[model samples]
Target: MQEILNLEPQNIWKNFYDLNQVPRPSKKEEKVIKFMMDFGKKLNLETIKDSVGNVIIKKPASAGMEDRKTIVLQSHLDMVCQKNNDVQFDFDTQGIEMYVDTDGFVKAKGTTLGADNGIGVATIMTVLESQDMVHPPIEALFTIDEETGMTGAIGLDETILQGEILLNLDTEEDDELTMGCAGGLDVTATKSYSVENLSGDFKSLKVDIKGLKGGHSGGDIHLGLGNSNKILGRFLHESLNFNAQISSMNSGSLRNAIPREGHFVISTPTANFDELKSALENLKKDILIEFQNVEPNIQISVSDVELATNVASQDETKNLAFALMTAYNGVYRMSPEIAGLTETSNNVANVVVGDGEMKILCLTRSALDSNKKNLSETLKATFELCGFEVSFSGGYPGWRPNTNSEILRLMEKLYKEMFGEEPKISATHGGLECGIIGGHYPNLDMVSFGPNIFGAHSPDERVEIKSVQKFWKFFVDVLKNTPKK
Candidate 1:
């Protein structure tokens, strides 16, 4: 990690190193909040914290640039905490051990390097402390809990901010300016089942599916990646030919993460046990062929396990399996206005059976209100027909793009002048805090851009080394070129 401290952009890297010393996982950002507060107070800036733990620090403009309008630099404080299964580090007590790789990427050792928003936060902090920066008044807004629920963005008081121009530094691409993002909501369906004693004449087995590349449910939904729940559902649906009964089912842990692994316990009559094994082998082959390109590491294994006393009835098991097999699990539509953009999609995120109840959670997203509603309602109706109680929660709005805004025009001009190339203007399918924040501050002109980052929200997350230096230069140039109030 010493190599990171010696990177070209000392200001940003210094602050980012400090951030790595604090644990700030989603919903648990107290330590990082205190760090920000102390850092602001040390700089003699007017720092305040909102009821929901959002921090706003005000810095006066440099001597000759007071006439420029105040710009709000925003980034969330929390990161998605994901570590390799074999790693024993605890997120609550330990900080992420980030390292500079030989490939010129900043990554953590067996964990997610909080560079998603950490870099953004560090850049804002560096700008706040710089005395030579020729900028207007600045409001550094640090939000909380963005990874899981977006509690900070949703609950923030818009009145606390005095800026009408907001710059969100949370996007992943370095050469792209994100103008808009999709709105999203979580949908969950539940059903009850009765278990009966398993006959001694039946054999039990546990089927495990592993090694799939489960990515972001929203950003990677259109990538044709395999969903573990859906894959297991298909296997179960076909395996029913051998009269296997499901004892219990579980898949995926987070709703926002596409499932990478799944497990199902099953019971088959002793008479057909051999046939059931043969059938599962054939089904595995078919699944492997189907996802051969995208999910090359896909693995399916069946192991003998001790029999359980109770298992779901054949009818109940079959119904659940078929329901999962038919559920919507990928991009449903593409944007007509923007070429190659996803307009609507669904992620069949998680499924679990426990305590006589089975729950299935799916997430839906769209840029248009009507499309979001229509897709969500369609999912609800479809699952209801499967005899499961369905409900929606945590709906957030989408950020509407302002193509003719003065800030965007200025940023574009400066970017081209500095880099000798035009930045790509685009919209993302994933949920961004800009949407929720924009909903509250209707007059604010917002745009998001950042350095290059890859494999976010997973253990493979990494930040590009050269992109950080380029992003820092662009950021400083923007500050020196802010338009007059």
Candidate 2:
């Protein structure tokens, strides 16, 4: 813990350590809210906690920078809580336990490091309390529940902030400035199915799917990684030849993360058990070859399991399996304007089957609102055709790009002057708070940039140490050069 506090730019790292000591999962940010409030009050800054749980701390400009326009430093408070299945820790009860690795990365022990927005929050805190830094008047806006939904930004009071420009510190890449981001919609499909008695003649097998690199549904959706929900569907679809019936299924968990593993219990007649084994082997080989380049560690296996007294009825079983196989998954469209940019995508995030009921959850993202609706409708139609009731919620607009804006030009010039390499001008596929906040403050100039953080929204999340130092240097300079009012 002392070593982490001793890292370069001690102010930022120490604040980060202090922030992570509170249990701050998405939609459960009471402790962190109190922490931020106390930090602001203790520093003698004017802090306001809005009704929606967002925290705002204001600091006046320094001597030479008082003529510059005010700007908002924004980051989310909640993090996506994910851990290895073997790790036994409670997110609602414990703070993240992180360590600096020998390979120049800071990571958590078998859990997500919460660097998605924790570093940004810490950097804002440092600037707010700094007496030596030259910067414009700052309004530090710490939003809530960004990972689960943009409810904080969505429900914010429009009159609270007086800033003319907004700086979002949530993007992952260090050398990239994010000018726009896609909107998101949560698509859920659910239904109840009938159950039937399992006969004594049925032999059961547990099909396990594991080892896929599941990541952020929007940021990593273009990577073409394997989805466990879809993979389980494939295995079940293949089992039709053996007359297998589903007894229970549990795959994936979060609506924002790509599912990495699945556990399903299925039963077939004893007469067909021998033939099922051979067929399973063939299917596994084909799946491996299909994803060999990206998912070399993909594992699929079947083992004996005790039979349950009941299973999904034959008709319901076939309907669910076929729907899972036919449903939309992965990137739907690529941006014709930008090379290698995903325009629209979907993640079959989770699927749970048990207790004679099933629910399917998916996340859809796109920079265009019409395209967003189109993809979502297409998914709704697919599930509806399979006898499931579908609905869409938590819709947020995308941030439109302003390429010729003052902030973009200023940051681009500063980045090249400092790094000797032109920073990449790009937009993120991930859902950023910029879009929602921009909707309320229509005239505010906005751009998002941050240090290098990778594998966000997953347990493999890590942050680059060297990149943080470089980002800090550039950040302070940007504040120092804010446009004059």
Candidate 3:
């Protein structure tokens, strides 16, 4: 903790330490709401907590900068709650245990370091309390539920914000100034089937797939990382040839994260159990050889387990396995307009089957509205043909890139002057609140930039220390350079 406090940018890290102490998981942010409210009041700023739990703190311009345009600095309050499965910490009650990694990154112990947006929030807090920092009139917006549904940004009352420019500090790469981001749709598939009684001669076997490098489904989807759900589903689908009957299965958790672990229990007649086990073992070897470079630590283990009383219906099991194996994942398409940008993609993030019921969740993303619907239709057809009811909800439009943006021009010029090189102007595949917030305030010129944050939406999340120092200086300068009204 002291090491973090000693960083070059003391204010950002110190405020980050204090902010991390309060639990701020998505969908459950009551405590954080209060924490932010208290923070604003303690600074004696004009703080207002909206009816929908968004916090806005207004600060007057410093020195002679009152003629500059009003700027709204924004960051989400809630973070993606993910952890190593073996870790015993409860996100709901315990503060994240953070440490400085041997490698130049600050990370949390077996949990996500909330640096994805926490650093932005802390930056805003520091600016709000600063006595001498040059800036225009500032409205600091700390939104909630960004990691999950982005409901706070969606539902924010439009009447509050009076800013002409919004600087969103939520992008991952420090050098990349994001003018756009892909929208997202949540796809849920569900069905229930009858379970048949296990025969007396049946034997139980447990299978596990672990150690794959799961990551942010949006940012890392193009990396070709393994999805545990896809891995287990492929195995079970292949095992069906040997007449294996699934008793229970579970894989992944959050819809927006790539799955790292998968587990299932199945049974087969004792007469041919050996043959099925041998085939599975051989397939594991093939899998290891197939993904040797990417998934060196990936393990596919099988062991004996206590016999289960019921097995999922054979027909239903076949359908479920088929759907999982056929479900499209990974980079669906790259942008034609922007070279090297992913235009559309899907993550088969979660699957569960047991107790005569099965559920699957997928998050699909695309910058083009038509492509988004088309991809969702393709997935819907795939699952529906397999006898599952698919539904879409929690949809949010992507932020369209505005090449002629005034704020973008100002930042581009400022960045070149400050760093001696032009910043990368790109649109992210990940979801950001700028689109939603912009919808409410059409005239607001928005852009997002942040320090380097890697492995977001997963337990491996970390942020670079040096980049925070660099980003802080640039952030302050942007405020100092706000255009005259």
Candidate 4:
């Protein structure tokens, strides 16, 4: 606990340390919610928990500031539970293993640091507990299950909130002020085919692509990072030119991340085995050079395996490969309205090979509802054109930017005053609770801002300690100078 206070501004880091001590993975945030509720009661703030487990704590305005406009500070209570395969920790039972890295980044050992939204929660908690801080009436909204889905935000009652302005603390970059975000849907494609025994003499080989840094498909899409599944599909697409047969394919685990590594089993005639190996070696070099700056260590390997009789027919294999190759992944369109902003993107997150059919799951995103629908339809059409069945679900709407927002102007002015510089206002590629919150609270004015966080949804995730200080200062300033109605 002493180590916690050593970070900065003392109380904020203490609350952040306390948060790290709780196990609050997405959809499993009961203990954390109870803790927050208890803390709210101790502070004499009005606390309420809805039926779906979302918590809201209300703090009255500071002395002489009671008549100022009300404001809501929002952040998700749950974190994405991901860790290295070798690390043994249950998100359902154990707290995250926290440590201060040499780079002054706070991280979790072999697991995601949860800084994506944890820092946001801590910042709000710190403000809530501060007795000397002057501000308008404040509502701290802690939502549940934001990582897996926007369930808590979706189910929240609009009437519960008195604030017409909302400040979301879930963006990653420190200086950038996010004005909007992309909506998204998940697509699952399934097909069934007959497996037949191979009659020809063939050699079994496992083809692997690994060592790529796969980040969020939406945030890191334009970076030209490698997608192992797409790379594998390309390899197979080219191998088919040499008459190679695939046995099984698997890649990526989550629906929102780009695949870092993938492997597929292929059966080739004994005479073509050497040709396949040579082709893989050449392709590996080409890929390494092509993605040299982004994925330097990308490797494509071919090794022998026991020949299996149960394999998809050649036509089925070709169709699957074609679908994967043609299916949309990464940025589909840039916002014509906002320069250099991604308007839509897709993440082909999972591919599983079954007995008869191969299943590919994709997650698509867009800030515009029409764009989201169009991209989803385009992806479905691509699969249909490739002769596979496609279905989409888990769709959510985007939060449109309100340029005439009074709260936005207030925060912008406060940010400039606090930092002596203008904040970078822009939209985010990833979804946030603001979108769903807006659906329920149509009059709510929303804008999101946060400290510098990197590698969200991955084991390498970390939050900049210094940026947290600035973020807290700016947040306090916004509350202190909120506009009067």
Best by TM-score: 3
What C-alpha lDDT does candidate 3 achieve relative to the native structure? 0.91
Candidate 1, TM-score vs. the true structure?
A: 0.96
Q: Write the per-residue lDDT of candidate 3 for residues 396-479, one digit (tens) a residue.
A: 999999999999999999999999999999999999999999999999999999999998988889999999999998988898
TM-score of 3: 0.99
What is the TM-score (0 to 1) of candidate 2? 0.98
Off by over 4 Å in 4: 1-4, 42-44, 85-89, 197-200
Give me the displacement of residue 439 in model 2, in angstroms.
0.9
TM-score of each: 0.96, 0.98, 0.99, 0.93
Once model 3 is optimally superposed onto the true structure by TM-score, how far is the C-alpha of residue 394 displaced, in angstroms? Answer: 0.3
lDDT of 4 at 53: 94
Best by lDDT: 3
User: Each candidate's lDDT (Cα)?
Assistant: 0.88, 0.91, 0.91, 0.84
Q: Write the per-residue lDDT of candidate 2 for residues 229-263, one digit (tens) a residue.
A: 99889888888888888888899878889998887
Model 3: residues with Cα > 4 Å off, grouped in runs? none
Which of 2 and 4 is ahead in TM-score?
A: 2
lDDT per residue for candidate 1 within 1-485, as digits (tens), equals 67888997988998998998899988889999999999999999999999999999999999998899889999999988777656899999898898899999999998879998999999999989997888889999999988778889999996999897999999898998899999999899998989778757888888888777776777788899988899889778876887888888888767777888888988889888888888888888888999999889888897789875577778878878878977888998999999988999998988997557889998889999898899889888878887889999988888888898888889999999999999989899988999899888888888899999887877778999999999989988998888898
Model 2 C-alpha lDDT versus the unseen true structure:
0.91
lDDT of 4 by residue, 357-384 (tens): 7899888999888888998999899988
